[model samples]
Target: MGRKSNQQFVQIPLAKLKERIKQLCGIYGIRYVETEEANTSCASYLDGDSLPKYGEKPDGWKASGKRIKRGLYRSKDGSLINSDLNGSSNILRKVARNLGIDLSRLGRRCLTSVRRIRLWATKSNLTLKNARAFTPGS
Candidate 1:
């Protein structure tokens, strides 16, 4: 998260990656629509924050949750969830809004219980400490 140069380098290939995704979607007859993810990374999905566009946020707008540290987001109730997961949920919420899908039933348990699958060189190497290291908190 501290590597600005690495982020810039990654951005260089993003356009190409988008093009490839578009091509693949077209081939597979999958609908693809690129949506603007302005405040997705900052807004709290659990708190139902009004996710606005890049410059459309109201004055003094603030999320009920925030990224407390790298790869972690702290919710309004002091619960910590993966930052990427929170952003991803916000993105899905945006898409659902556009599609008029009802996600009102989705709750904290659904998000908190999500398990991340890791690929280790060997199964024995996946110790409890190492496994829990990447979870909500260390």
Candidate 2:
């Protein structure tokens, strides 16, 4: 006698299923249009070249083999002294200023997370002493 095979089927709720589908579509850049004509129009707008290829160096490939030079205010042990600010933070703030973003807005948007901002600040040579002095109630 042959052994019988067992199988099980599961059903998901429609709303949850739709939400999952929408997330998947967004990840894959799939546009769902209401009408057939709209779908055709959307298809024309898609860029076939935007998809990234596996194991390929992206456009504007450069190989200088140089590490990003750290800014002043970093200690010999790679910790920030009391005076260093992250190089990238300075650059971002400069760009934001050039683009006419308010200083308060730039401050808010430039460093969203304290941990990451602190790390960047330390890495860029913004020392703990300087950071505390600049920040109120540090």
Each prediction's RMSD over C-alphas, in Å, is 9.3, 17.5
What lDDT tens digits, residue by residue, belong to model 2 across residues 1-138? 333432344566977877787888889997432211111111111111121233454676432221234322332334332222232344334344345544443232333233344322344465765677899776
Q: What is the TM-score of each candidate against the true structure?
A: 0.66, 0.18
Error of 1 at 29 (Å): 1.4
Q: Report the error of model 1 at residue 65, Å.
A: 1.3
Q: How does residue 3 of candidate 1 score in lDDT?
A: 83
Give per-residue CA lDDT, model 1, range 32-62, as digits (tens): 8888898998888888898898789999999
Backbone clash pairs in model 1 (N, Cα, C under 3 Å; residues 3+ apart or in different chains), count: 0
Query: TM-score for model 1?
Result: 0.66
TM-score of 2: 0.18
Candidate 2, residue 85: Cα displacement in angstroms equals 6.4
Which lDDT value does model 1 have at 75?
87
Clash pairs detected, candidate 1: none
